[model samples]
Target: MNGGPRLFSILRQGPYLIASIHTALDDSQLVRFQQDLVERIGSDRARGVVIDVAALDVLDSFASRTLRDIGEMARLRGAVTVIVGIQPDVAFAMVELGMDTGRVVTALDLEEGLAELDTYAAAPPAPRR
Candidate 1:
């Protein structure tokens, strides 16, 4: 993707990739966003993907589904995905609209999201003695 105006920003934070959406995205930007995320994940090989959507006030069905899809794709690429920063209104709207995020995990904020992702990335607990 061109380095033009980006709808979102992706930063490599340790073993996790944090993608924060800064604005309301149109359909085209959404597509570009997906492509960019895929490229970033592929190149970085991050252990987890944390998407911070605190700035986004509106979470439409399309956007929600796209995020879910992205999370699934990230997992396929060997990285767990955690979506954080969901607004109260957006959460209510999503529930009222019956928009499901499938298996995508969610957290209250970036810190919590990263914590959850770490759990996913960490090695499993040892067997019982």
Candidate 2:
């Protein structure tokens, strides 16, 4: 279980679920968030997910992996995942670490994330590889 109250909020907007992380979460909390998010994606029948990590000053490897896994899990449930609001420092560190972004897409902010989803929706579907 998470160590305390939820550290983030997930709200569904239309076909997208937005998860805003306003603070750093412990390992357990991060895992819980990932699980809860994936479950919510299925339950809500979301077509896309936006994870905003603007408030987090650091992005450790574990967190990066968890984000990637969340995207992959959501994809398996027929949803796209976009990560928005990555601070410049965190983005630099992620680049320096050669972090693999995997299935998640990145955007400048929530607006752009939602726009990305909109574009995805308007585009023709891709054939599965």
Candidate that scores best on lDDT: 2
lDDT of each: 0.88, 0.91
- Model 2, 1-129: lDDT tens digits are 358766899998998999999799888989989989999998999999999999999989999999999999988898999999999999899999998678689999999999999999888989988
Model 1, TM vs. native: 0.90
TM-score leader: 2
Give the Cα-based TM-score of candidate 2 against the true structure. Answer: 0.93
Model 1 Cα shift for residue 75 (angstroms) = 0.9
Over the full model, what C-alpha lDDT does candidate 1 score relative to the true structure?
Answer: 0.88
Residue 110 lDDT (model 1): 92
